[model samples]
Target: MITEKAPGKLYIAGEYAVVENGFPAILVALNQFVYCSIEPSTNGTGKIVSHQYQNNAVQWHRQGDQMIVDQRDNPFSYILSAIQVTEEYARTLNKPLDVYDLHIDSELDSASGKKYGLGSSAAVTVATVKALCQFYHLPVNNDRIFKLAAIAHFAVQGNGSLGDVAASVYGGWIAYHSFDRQWLAEQRKFLDLTTLLNLPWPNLKIETLTAPANLALVIGWTGKPASTSQLVDKISLFKARQQAQYQEFLNASRQCIQRMINGFHAGSLEMIQTEIRYNRSLLQELARRSGVQIETPVLKQLCQIAEQFGGAAKTSGAGGGDCGIVAIDAQADLQSMINQWTAENIEHLPLAVHFMNNVHRYTIKLK
Candidate 1:
C-alpha cells in the first residue's frame, strides 16, 4: 500500500480574512498527522473503508450516477470531495489513474474527549491528496499539494484558505502574504539551530518553558459542533455592513500579531500582552456583528475572572465557538487557574514546537 501523512494546524492571525483578499495568516502544523494507505484493486468492486472503530465502519460502492454510502455517521461529502479532487489533480498532471482500494488511518484525536482545535478535516484531506500523489508518481511539491487541497475544500465549502494545509505540508511558521489576487507563502526557518523543522527563532530559546509569563490561556469547549460555514457567511455579511469597524479590527489584529512576531524575535515574552489584548479587543467587535455570544456563558465568566487576575482573553478558533486563549501575567496564578478550570470541562492542551518532515517518495512492499 502507498502511504502519506499530513499535519493539523492552528491559526495565529487572519482567521476570518483568510478567504478574502489574502489576509496574513500564521499557522503551525501540530505533531498530530493523518495517514492514508491504498492498494490496487482487481475487481470492479470499488471499496472505500474508514476505520472509525467506535462507530460502524463506513463502506461504499460506486453506483451508476453516485456512490452508495452504507454508513450514515461518516459524511459522504468528504469522500466525494476527495475523489473529485484526486481526479482533477491527476488530469491536470496528465497522469493515467484508476479507482483503488483505499484505507485511511490517523492518530489524530477524533474521540470526543481529546478534541482539540487541530485541523482533523484538513489533515485527512491532505492524506488523501498525498495518496493520489503516490498513485500517479507525480512530482507534487507542498505548494501544489496545497492548491489541490484548497480545491477540495472549496468544493466542500465555498471558500477555504490554504493556511491549515500549508503549515501541515511545509511544517513551520508559514508567512502567507495576501495580494489582490492570490496568497503567497514564505517559510520561516532559523538557519543555525536545528530542531528537525521546529522553526525555532534565532534568538529565542526553545526551552524558555515558563509558558508565556505574560499570557496565561484557558481554552474551553462551547459544547456545540458549530457549523463553521454559517459563521463565516455571517461574518461576510457583517463586514459588508460594518465596513469601517471591520477594517479597524483587521488592522488591529494585524498590528497585534506582528508585534508578537517581533517579541518572539526579541526574546521578550513581556511584550506579548499588548498585542494579545489588542487582538482580543478586535475579536470582541465580532459580537456586535454576530449578534450572539460566540463566547459561552461559562467562558464569559472565565474571561471575566481571568481579567480580574490579569491580562485579556480571546476565542482562538472561529468566534462562534470552539476554544480560546487567555493572556496571564505576573499577578496571575496560571497553574492553579488552569487546574481550577480543568474541572469545569475546560482542557489545557499544551502547545509545543510541532514538526513535519519532507518526503520525496514512498516505498511499498508486499509482506
Candidate 2:
C-alpha cells in the first residue's frame, strides 16, 4: 500500500482578487491534512472509501482507459478526477493501469463532519495525485504534483485561484500568482497531460516565503461553515455589474499583497501585521461594494478581539463564516486573546504551519 498526505491551507491575504490571472495571494499549509492510501486490488475492481461519507463508498471499474462510476456520488468527484488525470499522464509514459482500492481520511474538518474552512478538497486532490504517482512509479517532484493536482482540481471545482492546491502540494508559506484559466482551457484541447505539465503557464507563479522568527499565527473558528463557491459566485456577479469598482478592488488587493510579500521576504513582523490589517480593511470594503458578506458579524468580533490583543486578524478565505487568521508578535499575550475568543464562543484552533522542505526546489518558468 502507498500512502500520501497533503496539508490543509488557510489564505493569509489576497482572497477575491487572486482569482484573476496574475493576481497574487498568500497562503500557508496547516498541520491538518487529508491522507490517501492506495493498494492493488486482486478482484479486478476498485473502490473508494472515506469515513466522512460513512457507507457511501464508490465502486468503480475501467471501461477501456475511462473510469466509470455512478453519477449520484458527488463526494467521489475530486478523487475520480485525480485518478483519471493521473492515469492519462501514465498512459503518456506508456505505463499500464491497474485496479486499486483507495481510502481517504481527513483531519480538515470537525468530528461532526463540519468543514473548518481548511482546504480539504484541495488537500484530498493533492494526496490522491501524489499517492497515484508513487503507486505508478512515476518520477514525481513538487512541480509535477502541483500541476497535476491543480489540473484535476480545476476540472472539478471550475473556479478559484488554485492557491489552495499550491499550498497543499508545496506546503508552508507561499505567495501564489494564478495562471490564465482561459488559456489553460484552450491548451487542454490539444496538449497531452505530460506536455501540458511541462509548458510554462502564463502568469502562474509560486514562491515559498519565510515568516519572521517572532511572528505568531493564530486561528479561530466561528463554527459556521460557508460555501466558498457561492460567495465567489456572488462576487463574480458583482464584478459583472460594477466593473469599475471591481477593478479598483483588484488593483488595491494586488498592491496590498505585494507589500505583505515584501514583509515576508524581509522578515519584518511589524510590516506583515500592518499589511494584514490593511488587507482586512480591503476585504471589508469589498464586502460592502460587492454586497456579499465576506466577513460576518461574528467574524468582525473575532478580528476586533485580535486587534485588542495586539494581533492583526481577518477572515481567512472567501469568508462568509469559517475561520479567521491572526499574525502577532510571539511574545504577545496569545493565551489572553484565545481566552477572549472562547468567551465569544470562538474555537481557537491550534494549527501550526506545515512545511515541506523540498518544495522550494521546484521553480516555474514564466511565459
Candidate 3:
C-alpha cells in the first residue's frame, strides 16, 4: 500500500487578477491535508473509497481503451480523472499499468464537514496523481505531477487559476502565475493526452517565497461557505463591463503583490503591513466598481477587528465568504484578536505557517 498526503491552501493575495493574463498571486499551504491511499489489486479493476463524497465508494475498470465506473453518480470524478490521465501517460511510454483501490480522506474541514474554503479539490487531485505515479513507478517528478494535477483539475472544473494545485504540489509559501487556460483549452482540440503533457506550459511562474520573520499568520473562518466560481464570475462580468476601471485595478493589484513579495524577501514587516492594507483597500474599491460584494459584511468586520488589534487583514481567495487572513507582529495582541473574533462569532482556525524545506512533493509512504 502507498499513501500520499498533500496540504490545502490559502490565497494570501492576488485572487481575480491571476485569472487574467497570468498575473502573480501568493499562496500558503495549510498544515491541513487531503490523503490518498492506493494499493494494487489483482482483479484488473479499480475502486475508490471517499467518505467525503455522498456516494462513498465507486468501482471502475478499464474497457479496451476507456475507463468505466460502476456508479453513475461518480463521486470521485477528480480521482478517476487522475487515474485515466496517468494511465494514458503510462501507455505513451509503453509502461505497464495496474489496477488499484484508492481510499481518500481529508483533515481540512470541521468535524461536521464544513469546509473552511481550503482548496480541497486541488489537494485531492495532487495527492491522487502523486499516489498513482508512486504506485506505478512512474519517473515523474514534482513539476510533472503539478502539471498533471492541473490538467485533471481543469478537465473537471473547466476553468481555474491552479494556485491551489501549485501550493499543494509545492508546500509552503509561494508566488505563482497561472498557466494560460485559454491556450490550453484551444490546444486540447488537436493535441493528444501525451502530446499535451509534453507541451511546455509557458508563462506559468512559481517561486517559493519566505514570509517576513516577524509576521504572524492568523486565519478566521466566516461560518458561511463561498463558491469561488460564482465570485470569480461576478468579478469577470464586472471586468468586462468596466474595462478601464478593471485595468487600473489590475495594475494596482500587481504592484501590491510585488510590494508584498519584496517585503517577504527583505524581511520588512512595515512593507508587508502596508501592502496588506493597500490590498484590502484595493479589493474593496474593486468590489464597489464591480457592483459585486467580494467582501461580505462579516469579512469587513473581520478586517475591522484585525485593525483594531493593530494587525492588517484581508479576505483570502475569491472570498465573498470563507476565511480572512491576518498578518501581525509582536505589537499585536494575538489573544486579544482571538477573543474579539470569538465575540463576533468568527471561528479562529488554529492554523499556522507551513514551510516546505526545499521539497516539492508530498511525503509518500509504502506499507
Candidate 4:
C-alpha cells in the first residue's frame, strides 16, 4: 500500500478578487492534513472509504475506459473525481491502470460531519492524486499533481480559484494569481485530455513566499461553517450586475494583496497589519456593495478581539462563517488572545505553517 498526505489550506488574503482576472491571493498550508492510502483491490473492483464520511463508500468499475462509481450522490465526490481525472491522465501517457481500494483520513475537523472551512476537499483531492500516481508508478511532481488535482476539482465543483489546491500541492505561503477560468473552461470542453493536461496555464501565477520571521499566525474558528462555492457564486452574480464597482474593488484588493506579500518578505509588521486592515475593509466594502455580509457579526468580533490583542485579524475565506486569522508580532501574548477568543465562544485552531518554501511533495510511506 502507498500512502500520501497533503496539508489543509488557509487564505491569508485574496478571496473574491482572485476569481477576477490577475488578482493575487496569499495562502498558507496548515499543519493539519488529509491523508490517502491506496492498495490493489482483490475483488476486481474499486472502492473508496473515508473516515470522516463513514456511510459514503461505494463500489466502482471501469466502463469503456471510464471509471464510474456506484452512487452519484456520494459525499466523497472529490476523491472519485481525482481518481477519474488521474486515470485519464494515465491514458495520455499510455500507462496501464489498476483497480484499487482507497482509504482517506483527515486531521481537518468536521465535528459532527460539518466542515471547518480548512480546505479539506482540496486537500483530499491533492492527496488522492499523489497516492494514485505513486501507486501506479507514474512520474509525478508537485506541479503535475497540482494541475491534475485542479482539473479534478474543477470537474467536481464547476468553479474554484484553486488557491487552496495550490497551497495543498506547494505546502507553504504562496502568492497566487488564478488561471483565467473563463478561457480555461471553454478550452476544457474541446481540448483533448492529453493536450489539456499539458497546457502551461499561462495565466496562472503561483510563487512561494517567505513569512516575516517575527510574525505570528493564529487561527480562530467562529464555530460556524461556510460554503465557499456558494459565496463565490453570489459574488459572481454581484460582479455581473455591478461591473464598474466590482472593477474598482478588484483593483483595491490587488493592491492590498501585493502589500501583504511585500510585508511578508520584508518582515515589516506595520506594513502587514496595515494591509490586513485594508484587506478587511475592502472585503466589508465589497460585501456592502454586493448586498452580502462577508464579514458576519462574529467574524467582526474576532477581528475586534485580535485588534485588542495587538494584531490584525480577518476572515480567512468566503466569510459568512468559518475561521478568521490573526497576524501579530511574535512576542504578543498568544495564550491571552486564545483565552479571550474562547470566552467569546470562538475556537482557536492552533495551526501554523507545517512546511517551508518549495517543499511541495506529499509525505509518502509504504505499508
Highest TM-score scorer: 2
Worst 10 residues of 1 by lDDT: 201-210
lDDT of each prediction vs. the true structure?
Answer: 0.57, 0.90, 0.82, 0.84
lDDT of 4 at 265: 75
Stretches > 4 Å off in candidate 3: 42-45, 55-75, 193-195, 357-367
What RMSD, rounded to one decimal, does every model reach? 10.0, 4.9, 6.4, 6.1
Clashes per model (N, Cα, C within 3 A): 3, 0, 0, 0
Measure candidate 2: CA RMSD.
4.9
Q: TM-score each candidate.
A: 0.73, 0.94, 0.89, 0.91
**Tens digit per residue, CA lDDT, model 3, 148-228:** 888887777665598898889888888887778888888878888677776677578788877777788899999987767
lDDT of 4 by residue, 1-367 (tens): 8999999999988888997766789999999999999989999998888878785446577999999764422448888899998888888788899888999998886567767888988998899999988887778777788888988887777666888898898887888888877776788789976776566775687888777888899999888887787788789899899999999999999989988888877978889889988999999999999988799898988999999989989999899999999999889998998899899999888887977445743332100
User: Per-residue lDDT for 118 in model 1?
Assistant: 64
Of 2 and 3, the candidate ahead on lDDT is 2
Q: Give the Cα-based TM-score of candidate 1 against the true structure.
A: 0.73
lDDT by residue (172-243, candidate 1, tens digit) is 544444332221222213221112122321111111112343443444443444445556667777788889
Query: What order do candidates take by lDDT, descending?
Result: 2, 4, 3, 1
Write down the lDDT that model 4 would get. Answer: 0.84
